[model samples]
Target: MIRRTTAAKGLALAAVLSLGLAACSSDGGEAGGGETTDTNGNEETSAEPLTIGTILPVTGTLAFLGPPEIAGVGLAVEHINEAGGVLGNEVSVEWGDSGDTTDYSVANSTATDLINKGVSAVIGAASSGVSLAVVDTFAEAGVMQISPANTATDLSGYGPFFARTAPPDTVQGAALGSLILDGGHCRVGFLVQNEAYGTGLRDNVQQAVEAGGCEVVYGGTGGGQEFAPGETNFGAQVTDLLAQEPDAISIIAFEETVAIVNELVAQGWDFNGTTYFCDGNLSNYGDDFDPGTLEGVQGTLPGAQADEAFREELNTWYTENEGGELADYSYAAESYDATILAALAAVRGGATDGQTIADNIRAVSGSEGGTEVSTFEEGVAALEAGEEIRYVGQSGIGPLNEDNDPSSAFIGIYTYGADNTYTYERQIEGSI
Candidate 1:
């Protein structure tokens, strides 16, 4: 669910949301320990020590999302180790900071470092831009990589070794369009950033809305900014929206949705009794945007209260291990899944080496060996059985399609309740 805010006049924010949102290849035989012999005629163990690499933006703009993602990785690691390190050998992680920069040289250097250190696979670069920059390097090295939260459609076709937890923005946008129509909105406008993420999301929404029998009246565009964080000076865009007089205006931008909402309210622009927001603007964005301002907005996401059990568990874990707050972000869960998925792939491949693990990543995400498994434990068991394992994770239940893209369930629909609090509305009907 998302919050609704008033816009000034022009409702022109349907382009910026796509900005932030990977790759690799290898084919040779699997490397590392093959087989071993033991006394007493016991079967030899193929257990070999392995290390995995992780790159997260622990500082700068996206730092807030890093901690939870890292925590998820840690939890997955603990679970894997407790069950006996993959293949009977200890597994370890090597972490690096992406440092949040436009030039991904830092991220690329970090990936090279991990490759040199001999990690079996890599698990991050939370931001899609960073992931794209370093993906080729990892691919060249034959190291498999899986990002927890990148939704851009372009990345899916980048390489064989790439996979992600977030469904592409095209699917998400389409889902949101259907949501807007089902919610009784006839005319939908959009506010977006002028980046890949935003354009991608806007395109999806446009297509979905058209398919859903809704009309697109206005679409706004803006450049990404760090200062606003969830607020935007969308006066120009709001003015345009007012002119279009759309029934609902979907802000497909980031960090500016709230500002657009608040400005509209201040200007006395009613939603004209329509709702606003898309997945890009679904976050709470902290205290910067008043909760009361979003009393009636809505959005489509990959999770929702339907998974209340997991939500409660996540909250409990944060309270116990963190400072009592789940970092205000959604990507954390996906990041954790990536780490776990990579680890499981390493185990199935039977070697910690990059080529071997990269070749076998499909075992965890593909259909041949992966079926009827949705939890981390289930994936591990399937791997142990020497059968291809289908790992349907906490993120969703869909299997990874041939493009290395997992079909995702749009289960998160939210609404703003009284007192600036948020509540889960209802889950969406199907997978994207």
Candidate 2:
């Protein structure tokens, strides 16, 4: 495989020195120990260690999602190691934080640190906009990047080494649009976050709604009804959105959703039963709002609901390792699936490099016909027996498409209760 490297700007001098020291300490083999055949048919030995890193949100607007995502990665690592590790060596992980778009420096620095640490692949940046900021860096360094929750439609086919476990907004948007129309809402409005994720989903939802014979009364793409990412005060935007007299309104944002809801209540708008939320803001609002403040509100989140067994496993692993109770299982399944897929790809390709993982990820995901397996141990065993194995992980996603997006996925519908918490109503499957 061809190797690529570029100078990472803005990194601290200590980090560069650390990289140099690590290089000096190398045992003269590939970062992960593996044997490669030369052009002359001679076998050469190299180190084969698969180091995975993470750029998940630990702080910022999306921090609420951090616990489950982090737990998912940790659980997957534990499983892979228990399955005798990857490439004959224990798999190691380096964790870093990917703050929201409000601060690109956090993700930028984290990406640099992970790359410098010689990670073969990264799982990361739940926010699509945050992923967009650092994807090029990972690509330039030949590191595979797989996001568990980035759903922006344009991110499909964005990079040869970039992939996501989450279905794009096309699936979630259609499901949400249908939900609104089915609720007898004829005039829909959107208060979007004015970013790749928000706008892309808004457009897809609008298309679905219009096709269903419902009119978008406000906040259509390019209508200038969007707000900045970190904008806290929503009085004017809420006033304008309410002025349109929309019966159904979707607030597509992150932490700012709390402020927007408060503004809506202050303006005498009945938020109950009329508000909608997307994955970016479908979190439990019990701590932020009064009881019954969000009663009857509905929202949509991508991915199939995790079953009880998997949830228990994740919670058990998290409490033991991270010392916390798992509050939500939003993208935990997706994150675990992403890690498992990468490990299976490494086993199939006989190496743990990013290019090898990228080349084999689709095949491991069942893009082509193979023996179906569901766990890391099963997949590794099948591959070792000279069988092509398809790894169907906890996330029940179909094979990877030509663009590296899931061919089909399930979108979960949820409704808020009187305590400002949401309960899963049902799941709708959509094919890209």
Candidate 3:
């Protein structure tokens, strides 16, 4: 009645040992004693607590995304450590900043420092530019990195080391294009941020629309000057965009999309003209903005909340552990799933070295041995049995291609009612 697999037992034992010590400890001063071999083929002892790093943009344009992403990662880590630490070592987490500037250089520096500190994996860089800056660093170091939110198309091919739980915005952009076509709009204007996230999404959507024989009326860049989340008063840009009077408009900034909506409302722009927002704008909808602002708006999202299967547990877990805050936005669930997938990969990889972990990531996310691993226990068993394992997680079934992009669960549709409630509309299963 109380049997445990070797990996599980190792993790449990490690957790006990870790709990006996401090919940947080740095390198060279931790509790456990089992040594794992490094890439150099030399035997190295596992630290008393295994450490992972999270790079979050806690105070910038993308700041709104950072907390939920961190919360998800933290929850996954907590769940893992509570069940059993990895390989019988308590899991510890370290923090680094992505800064508020949306600068990849800042993300790069922080990621580099984390690498030097010897973390097995990293769990963030929600901004696409930041992720791009550090992808090569993590890849070369053989460190496994899982992104919760970076949806830029450039990242799919960044490296073997870079993988994300969220489907890239290209998929969402294309779906939005289709949604526009379905809603009987032919020409539209776009006001996009000039960052990797905004540009990539806008480009994809524009390409999709062009391919569908539609025309782009006008496109301008925003978010390049004075980029800040929770900022409103886009009167200048709205005046310019309204001058074009296109059939519709796409707002592609992260949180600044709200500014665009507010600007439209202030000028009494036609909200009934099918203004479609991307996933980036999902979390920012609230009563702070006018209720009529997003009444007829449609949102294009990658993967939706599994509300029926996951909401109750999600709400309970978040409230108990995270002060009643739950991630109900894009990539929030995916981020949680990514953390679990990484931990499971570590267990299946049989060693904690970053290269081994990276290799194990593919095994779990790709189709090489999918049937063998469907749950945490199954993955551990497969590792013990020495069988290759593939972990298909709850973040909408992953089987990546050579580019490390998910094949299942393409872009989907969501509609925002005047009550500021988002409803999942439909799922698009093919490439746009």
Better of 2 and 3 by TM-score: 2
Kindly indicate the candidate among 1 and 3 with the higher lDDT: 3
Give one digit per residue, the lDDT tens place, for model 3 in 1-432. 011112213223443342221112222323654765432233554533456787766545666566566556665666666666677776666666675334456677777888887887888777787777777888787777888777898887677687777777767777888888888888777877666787888888888788889877766333243233345667876777678778888877776776677678778877664688876776546686767667778877776455554555555554654344554645656777777777766665556667666676666765575454545656655665556666765566567666666765656677777776677877766542
Model 1 lDDT tens row, 192-288: 6655566667777778888777677777323332122333477776776778878787776554565776777776665423665655456665465
lDDT of 2 at 269: 78
How do the residues 56-94 of candidate 2 rate in per-residue lDDT, one tens digit apiece? 886678877877887788789888888888867778777
Off by over 4 Å in 2: 1-47
Estimate candidate 1's RMSD in Å.
9.3
Ranking by TM-score: 2, 3, 1
Q: What value does the lDDT take at residue 357 in candidate 2?
A: 86
Give candidate 3's error at residue 225 in angstroms: 12
Candidate 3 structure lDDT: 0.66
What is the model-wide C-alpha lDDT for candidate 1? 0.62
TM-score of each: 0.78, 0.90, 0.82
Error of 2 at 234 (Å): 0.4
Local distance difference test, per candidate?
A: 0.62, 0.84, 0.66
> In candidate 1, residue 118 scores what lDDT?
74
